[model samples]
Target: MTHRRAREAAGDKDVLVLGVDVSRQMLGSGLLDEVHLHLMPVLLGAGAPLFAGVRAELLPLGEPVGGAATHVGCSVVFGP
Candidate 1:
């Protein structure tokens, strides 16, 4: 999914991109939310990356306040 979708999926809070390293023998995994899991297909031959350049702003989740079903978390807004 696109970053905007990811942000929307993540709710109204800001989205952060965490750094993850993967090896040819190791599996690559990503987390979008508690409901979804992000994974990439296996590549056996010499190939290029699925994504070229990605630019993102850092947004920290400051406070979380809400009920079990809904939440309003404090986040530093950063984007275009």
Candidate 2:
């Protein structure tokens, strides 16, 4: 679905999007308020690149919560 359609479909509920390309599209859509990223330590030799086509923007992050993986919270900033 397109971003506008997704936004309309979402209403007031939070939607979690998985995968790099979709995430990039969502980030560019200006419909997200915040993002939670789960960071794990592992190495896969070849894969899709994160932030491959994302524009330059600053996401203000909260202090990370650590566990088997680190959870980071960030608020999206939509303008230059």
Among the numbered candidates, top TM-score falls to: 2
- The alpha-carbon lDDT assigned to residue 16 of candidate 2 equals 74
Q: Candidate 2 versus the native: TM-score?
A: 0.71
**lDDT (Cα atoms) of all candidates against the true structure:** 0.37, 0.73
lDDT of 1: 0.37
lDDT score, candidate 2, position 23: 78
lDDT score, candidate 2: 0.73
lDDT of 2 by residue, 1-80 (tens): 77677768989977777877787777776656777788888756676675665554557586889999999878877765
TM-score of each: 0.23, 0.71
RMSD to native, candidate 1: 12.9
**Candidate 1 structure quality by residue, lDDT tens digits, 1-80:** 55658778989775655333221111122323221123345545675543233222324354334343333332222224
Each prediction's Cα RMSD?
12.9, 2.4
Residue 48, model 2: Cα distance from true site in angstroms? 2.8
